[model samples]
Target: MNYVILAGGSGTRLWPISRNSKPKQLSQLVGDLSMIEETYHRLGKNQSVFISTNSQFAPLIKKLLPDIPAENYIIEPDKRDTGPAMAFVAAWMSLKHPNNPMILLPSDHHIRDKRTFMEVIEAAENLINSRQVLINIGIQPTFPNTSLGYLEVGEEISKEAGVHVYEFKRQKEKPDYKTAKKFLDQGNFFWNVGSFAWTPNKFIEAYKKFAPVIGDHLNELIHDLESGGDGSEAFSRMEKVSIDYAVIEKIDPRQVLTIRGDFGWADLGSWDQLFDQLADKADAEGNLVKANWHGVDTRNTLIYGPADKIITTLGVSDLVIVDSDDALLVTPMSRAKDVKKIVELLSYKKLQQHL
Candidate 1:
C-alpha cells in the first residue's frame, strides 16, 4: 500500500503558534518533534510513503524528512482544497503506480494506540484487495463532538483480519449539538477522520461518476504529466471544494465500506484539543508548560512558548497562553476553538505580517 500524509492545512485554529509559513504539522506542538515527524515515525520505516503538500511546504518537508526520496513528494502547484488536491494526487499516482492501493492519512492527528491503528490499516488494505470498494477508516465517537464530521454506518458487511467492516449509509459534516447528541445516542455514528483507502484508478472513477468537472480536470492533469508539463493550469481550473462535499458524501453507499477504528484517535485541531491530548503530562497544578515557567496559582492552563523566555502566571485557570515571537494569544479554554476567527479578523484588517 502507498501511504500519503496530507500536510497542507494552515491550522488556523492553532494560530499565533501555527502560522501559514509554519503550520502545526511543522511545529513542535505535542512533543519535541513536529507533528509530521511523529506521524512519519508512527508509520515505521521501509514503506512507500509520500507527503502530499503544496509547493511552499515542499522544501521544508524535504528538510524535515530527508530519508523520504525526492521523487516521492507530491507537490501541488497551487493551494486548492482537498477535492482538487486529492484528485491531483490520484492522477499522479495512477500514472506512476496504478495497481497499488493508496491510503490518505492526516499529519496532525494524535493516536495513542499505534498497534490497533496499524491493525486497522492492515485490515483496510486486506479488504481493499479482496473487494472493490472505497474504504473509510472511521473512529468510534467518544463524545458528542459537533466540530467533527460523522459517518452514519449501516449493518456489518464483513470482518476482515479482526476488523469489522460496515456499510456506509451517509456522512453528516459538523451537525448541530442536538443532532450530534442524537447521533451519539443512536450508537451508529462514527467520527469521520478523513482517512480513506482506495486504488488510484478507483478514486478517479468515483470523481468521474459524482463530480464530472473534477474528473475532467483530473484527466487533463494526467495528460499534462504524461506530456512533460506541470498540471498547474488544470489544477487551478478545478473547483475549490472539500473532498467530503465533492465526492465522499455523494458516493453510492453500496460502493463505500467503513472500518471502526478504536485507536485512541484525536484530531489536535485546536489548543483545547491539544491540551486534552497532553493532559497526562500536566503538572501538579493542572498546568501543561513547555516554556521556562514559574507559576503561583496557574491551574488547568496550557502555557506554550519558547524555552528562552520565562512565562510566569498567577491566579489563572482554564486558559491557553501561547507566546510566539511575533504574537501572544491568551484565551479561555472554552474560546480556544474560536481562535480561527482571529486569523480571519487579521486577514480582514490586512495584517498579513501577523498572519
Candidate 2:
C-alpha cells in the first residue's frame, strides 16, 4: 500500500505564524516536529509514502524529509484542488504500482494517538484488499461540528461494517446551530475526515463516473506513460476540483465504505481550535498561554509563539494572540474563521511580503 500525503494547503486560517512560504503543515503548531514530520513518523513501517505538495514548497519538504526519495515528491506546478491532485497521484501510482492500494491523507491534521490510528488504517487496508472497495476513514462524531461534512452509514453486511457501507448522502456545508445539533442527536453520522483508501482501478472508475474531466486526463496520462512520456504537460490540461465533489458524492452508494477511526483527531483549522487543543491552559482569569506569556489580568486569551517576545496581555478575553519574529497576529477568537479573509485582504492590498 502507498500513502499519499496531500500537503498543498496554504493554511489561510493560520496566518502570520503560518505564512505563504511556511504553511501550517510545515509548522510546529502542536510540538517540536512539524505536522508533516509527525505524519511521516506516524505512518507505519514497510510502506512507500509520497507527498503531493505545491512546487513552491518542495525545497522545504526535502529539508524536512531528506531520506524521502526525489521521485516521491509529486510537486504540482499549479494549485489544483484535491480531485485533480488525486488523479495525478492515481495515474502515477497506477503506472508504478498498478495493483497497490493507496491511502490519501491531509498533511496538516493532528492525531493524538498513533496506536488506534494504525489499527484503523490496517482494518481499512484489509477491507480494501479483500473487497477492492473505495474507503474513507471516518471520525466518530464527538460534537455537532457544523464545520465538517457528515457521512451516514447504510447497513451492516460484514461485522467490520457495524453499519453498512457508507452512503454518499447529500453533502452539507457548515450548518446553523440547530441543524448541527440534530445531526449529533441522530447518532448515525460521522465526520468526513477526508482520509481515503482504494485500489488504483477503483479510483479511476470513480473518477470516470463522477469527474469525467479528470477521468479523461487520467486516460491521456496513461497513454502518455505507455509512450514513454512525462505526465507534467498532460496534467496541466485538467480543471481543479475537490475529491468530495468529483467522486465521493457521485459514486454508487454501495461501493464506498467508511471505517471508524478511534484515534484522537483534530482538524486544527482555526486559531480557536489550536488554542483549545493546546497541552496547557492558564487560570480562571482566562489567560491561556503557550510557550510565551508574561503578564497580569491577561484574562481569557490565547497566546503562542516566541518566548523572548514578552507578550503581555492585559484585560483581554476571547482573543487570539500569535507572535513571530517576522509577523504578529491579533484577532478576536470569534472571528478566527475570518483569518482567511485577512489573507485575501492582504493579497488585494499587495502585501505579499507579509503573506
Which candidate's lDDT is highest? 1
lDDT by residue for model 1 over 106-210, one digit each (tens)? 999988988888888898888788787889988888788998899999998877777888999999999998999999999999999999999999999988888
lDDT of 2 by residue, 1-355 (tens): 7888888878788887798889999988877889998999999533498988877898998899887888887766577788887887787778777788889888999998897777777777778889777888777777778788777775445545332344444445557778878878887677887888998777887887778878877888778756866667777887778888888878876677777676889898888888776635556675667656777656668788796768776666789888888878899989887888988999999999999
Window of ten residues with lowest summed lDDT in model 1: 38-47
Instruction: Quote the lDDT for 138 in model 1.
Output: 89
lDDT of 2 at 201: 75
**Model 1 pairs in collision:** none
lDDT of 2: 0.78
Number of the top TM-score candidate? 1
Worst 10 residues of 2 by lDDT: 161-170
**TM-scores of all candidate predictions against the true structure:** 0.97, 0.91
- lDDT, model 2, position 353: 93
How many pairs of residues in model 2 come into backbone collision? 2
- Count clashing residue pairs per candidate: 0, 2
